[model samples]
Target: MLEVQSSLDKFKKTTGYWDFMEIGIAAIMIPFFAYQAYRLPSILSKFGAILIAIWLTCVIYTALKLKKAKPHEGDSYIDYLRQCMEYLERHKILSRKLMLWYVFPCLIGVAMIVVGQLDLLDKSWEQIIDTRMVWITLLIFMAIVVFAHQTNKLVVKKEFTPRLKKVGELIRSMEEDQVES
Candidate 1:
């Protein structure tokens, strides 16, 4: 019980951490993306604009998702337990959906940035986007998708589910206590 509570307390900290992490990345990337849009020519400008828009939407979506887990104050023990369960369940649902909204843009941006840099070796941008680069980018994107899915599964199984189950048991016990009284 003590250990469960300890884990719960630690898990609670992550509720805020997600918001901070997301915001920090958004802060860093928004300006950079905007700058890319300003400086890049033609199609790359369009790509940069699309990337910025997607990234902004992702940031907003992620922020809202993380907000669902923020605990409110002044709840009684049973209510607090219930709130925790709701928070964890929200996290579980969001984790499953994260790939679609969060992973694709991130993977695309990362792959483009890395592969784009290869053009520094006197290769033309058009040449850089050749079949080999396409294959490599495709592979990287696939890897990121798998990694994100597995990570989400592992965190939910290891953290959110356990905390949710523990809080639920407490809620049930408290409800029974109230009923007995």
Candidate 2:
């Protein structure tokens, strides 16, 4: 039980740190993305900035959502563990849904920027779009998306999933012990 609590404490701290880092980076980049819209006179640039803004908004929203799962200190042992499990479950759900709420908007925003750049070069679609450059760019970004998704999945599988199971088992056994008493 002490070990489980220690593990949960670590998980909470790590989650809080991650949230802080993500929000901090987003805060810094918000101005940069806003400047991109203002600096680039292209419609695509403005729209791309909007999409990126949406992605950041989603990030903040999700972080806030995760923050709401805080465990109260005064709760009973089994109850506290249950709350910890709830927090981990929330993280698991959010991590699983990153493709919808996290990656897709950013991908579209980046694609818009690439298209805008190609257009600015005054190259026809066939000249630029058909070349190895565009294909390589697409492939690279796709690879990154896959890598990120798989990494998050692995984290949930390795870190959160086992912890969740252990917490659940702890709660169950504690309950059984109580009933036996």
Most TM-score-accurate candidate: 2
Best by lDDT: 2
For 71-168, candidate 2 gives per-residue lDDT tens digits of: 86655777778788888888888888878878888889988877775564578767886777689878989998989899988998999899999899
Candidate 1 per-residue lDDT, tens place, 87-170, comes to 778778877788866777666665555444444345776776664866786786788788888988898788878788888887
Task: Please list all clashing residue pairs in model 2, or write none if there are none.
Answer: none
Residue 8: error of model 1 in Å?
A: 2.3
TM-score of 2: 0.91
| TM-score for all models, in order of appearance | 0.78, 0.91
Candidates' C-alpha lDDT:
0.71, 0.83
Give the poorly placed runs of model 2, Cα more than 4 Å off: 120-125, 130-132
